[model samples]
Target chain A: MRIPLGRKIVTYFLLSTAALLVFMPTLMAVVMSFMTNQDIMTGSFPSAFSLDNYRRAFEQFSLMHYVINSLFVSIIIMIGQLVLSSLAAYAFVFLEFKGRDFLFYLFIATMMVPFEASIIPNFHTIRDLGWIDQYTGLTVPFFAMAFGTFLLRQNFKQIPKELREASQIAGMGEVKFYLTVVLPVAKTSLITLGVYGFLTSWNMYLWPLLATTNDSVRTVQIGLRQLQSQEQMNDWGMIMSGAVIVIIPTLILLFLGQKKLQRGLTEGALK
Target chain B: MTEAAATLSQEDYILFEQTKRKHRYKQFIKGMLFLLPSIVLFSVFLFYPLLRTIYLSFFLTDASGAPTVFIGWDNFVTLFQSSIFQQSIKSTFLFVLYTVPLTIVVSLFLAIIANEKLRGIGFFRTIFSSGMGISVAAASVFWLYLFHPTIGFLNIILDTFRLEKISWLTDPSWALIAISVTTIWMNIGFTFLILLGGLQSMDKYLYESADVDGAGYFYKLRRITIPMLSPTLFFVVTVTIINAFQTFGQVDILTQGGPQNATNFIVYSIYREAFTNYQFGSASAQAIILFIIILIMTIIQFKLGERKVHYQ
Candidate 1:
């Protein structure tokens, strides 16, 4: 069953090429970010490295403001979704009430309806609430997520029933038990949900675009688009630098929570 | 004494029933309290918007984005008649057709290649998975650099190969293709990981048995591996179709629905109609149409999958 040398070499060659293709664009972006405008225009490797592009990206495009906006929106949405979904999941897992199963199924059904279908009405709702161009508009609608609820509910159901009974006998209130015991026991899944929520919120484009018109509330994704459109074909280095800045946080998140992110993604499919 | 004992038992039973009722009421209240936040959010954001969209689809709206006139079925009729909407439908399906199958095939191939247990395989997996780190906006910007007609990396490579420099974004024919390429590259990481997971989780004893049967790699893959991996493949296909149908970020950033509406995907079409043109009624209709299309596609996939996918 030993593989032939030729076939093995071919497999390695193909895999390496595929891997290179995947990595090359990000690598190029990083390389181009430090290059001068002239070097980028000429499509040559940089002879001299400088921070000019990053400087231009910040000053010209107001990249820092957009970064802050994106961070603010993503963090708020992450925490909000985590809190709300976990509470909802806890009820579904531990509490018994009439129509509980029905309500849970209804919540799950929301996942089937894509956000695009509801954007028009959502826009009107946000506007009517006087929330447009505000952080509330950007973050509030996304605060409760069906996917997060489902993921947490699955994990919470796996927690032992005896633990709940023991906590009850110990005179621990439901809130206290949830905060101290349930959350800690389901920490990994919660982390997974958090990472997923952050990434999705950070990468959000359409909702933010529809909800915000002013520079004051624009997220990084929309900001990058504006930068690209405004700088169209003029300063490639600056634009690539903007791109680099936009992806850095997400890349860091991926690095820090690779396992959680992987599990979260596969969780949807496997279930 | 017997009469006193009967009275005591009756009091105890009445007390037990009262406490049970009280406890049930308390549990109900507690559960509702815990669920209140999600209920409020979902009602406002998801359920209300969904029903409103359907309602808006049948009525013409004013400039302030409020439904003004009862235009029963007019929006849908106009949408069906409009050449732009038709083109959008065509372009969206084209985009899906171009992207989903190619992505599945390419990712499956990469997964197979990366499935080998070799030294430094973890590094390769990281490299292959790196695209997952890039946001759509970021990826579009990076690709915008590469897709530049003159002095871009792609054109430079084309020059080296003695090929003509193609206008990747501006040309109508190439615009969708360019966007599709960018999407495929960005999506490779996720699909690859899923397929890789599927491949790795496959039972090794099957392969060992195949080897004992004198089956070659291709034979084993075709007979054993593919059937075993069908469940994962089904999942990937379903997810990919849904994702491809909702493609917006790339089209919005790269082509803005295009040079000649060649890259006008369904979501982008809805966006342009609702926001840019202020045609809420039309947009809602289009949105509903898109929703139905996705629902039908999902149902069809599941139906087809049930027949083909071998769940172990």
Candidate 2:
């Protein structure tokens, strides 16, 4: 559908204006991250940009340490969710046992129990496990996801039945079939689950705050909190730099998987 | 001789049925093996905590969260009478009210506009959805900077317009609204993406038919687009409302449930009651309340969503 010239101009005008409004806050943060404290205090766009804030953030806040911890935890949780959820989804779909639907629904029902409902006991569970300030504490509870399993199951269900029959006919065991056939065929779905897992884990705030007291186990989100809450934390430039660092990895992931990730994430949520 | 053959066949049939039953049982075991990890984790984290939170709500607990006394809803009574809890309840509902509809309407507008098949549309789509990339901590820090009492960009803008600067975070009147603005900005990314995906996946043939009938832009939007998009809209609204109720990270960072507790939503209240104050019983009660509110809202939305909203 081709638009008239005036309409096209108006469309572009509206789109650009809306985009700028949406991006304005982050854009300000990005712009301010390079400026000195004086520029930010005066609310001026500076003529000179400096890496001083980035350097100070790393030195004083130990921001890089938190970045690594966030990476380690997020990736570990992603792997755990991928493996465990895929296994459960494989059983739910490929096994075809009696009461399968019953079990699947039972599993999916847990999605209703938001973390707020369960955070108390889970905190004690971690503390009791002596996992406080441990990577395991930060990563383990999130390994089993009702939503991830459901997403994977939805995709796994789409695998052709004929493929399963062919595998069995070829004397391929179910375990081997899931490994070589089912998982590989559902590759896109797996990436979707993986990206979703990574993003959620990376952005987690409360649990990480509760689970880790020390910088040794703190993720980037908690790191930002600690940095912001520090006494005399008035260096807006440095704090903005830390904020920029925390978001870069996920943004990179989103950009790389832009077109596909949208569809993937939407399918994961909607299905 | 024929009778003997019939008896032998019946014995063989019984033997075959027994083996088949044994094989089916083995498959069940295998499936359970696949599911065992998740089941164990859920039992440990989700199921146990959910039940424990409910159970703990009725009983007073000492420090370390050990139940010391069974209060029989006295904790709830205290919460009802408590002025702070009342404020939190008010703040939470108001927070949802301030955030959800505005977020939905704004993002829906952006999604529809971004859906236009125009030049450089991908750039606009990326800009609109980039909020999905930002973390709560990062976004809050940015907001904190912007909401600073002095030398904040927002204040700078206000000064430029010759309007007196409002205390964005400290003033009770404006704190929740400021935080709500942050929440709305944070939400636009995911809501827009989902809504845009929904808009794009719609069958183009409907639009084609509308074109043939000489339907104008507003006519097609009103008669065709909105109704067709209702399911996605319903889904977005449900999720957004649930998220609004669970507003925590921003509140914790921005106000710490402060400035007269104007921004202390229920989740933050629960966090303080349990973690900071060690009043596990009160916190558990609050948790259960939050859960029920979300559950009821979800059920109501689904009920309405089932019969009315979703045009499916």
Clashes of each: 0, 0
- Clashing residue pairs in candidate 1 are none
In candidate 1, stretches whose alpha carbon ends up further than 4 angstroms from where it belongs are A1-8, B1-15, B298-310
Q: For each candidate, report its DockQ versus the true two-chain complex.
A: 0.72, 0.81
Residue B311, candidate 1: alpha-carbon lDDT: 52
Per-residue lDDT over A49-118 for candidate 2, one digit per residue giving the tens place of the 0 to 100 score? 9999999999988888999999999999999999999999999888867788888877867867889878
Report the error of model 2 at residue B159, Å. Answer: 0.7
lDDT of 2 by residue, B105-223 (tens): 99989988989888789888888888888999999998998888888888988999999999999899999999999999999999999999889888899999999999998999899
The docking category that best describes candidate 2 is high
Report the CA-based lDDT of candidate 1 relative to the real structure. Answer: 0.88
Model 1 chain A: ten consecutive residues of lowest lDDT: A262-271
List TM-score per model, in order: 0.95, 0.98
lDDT of 2 at A96: 61
lDDT of 1 by residue, B1-312 (tens): 999999999999999999999999999999999999999999999889888999999999997778999989999999999999999999988988999999999889888888887767777877777777788999998888889889778999999999999999999999999999999998887888788888877799988988888998899889998889888888888888899999999988888998899999999999899888999999999999988887787676657757653457
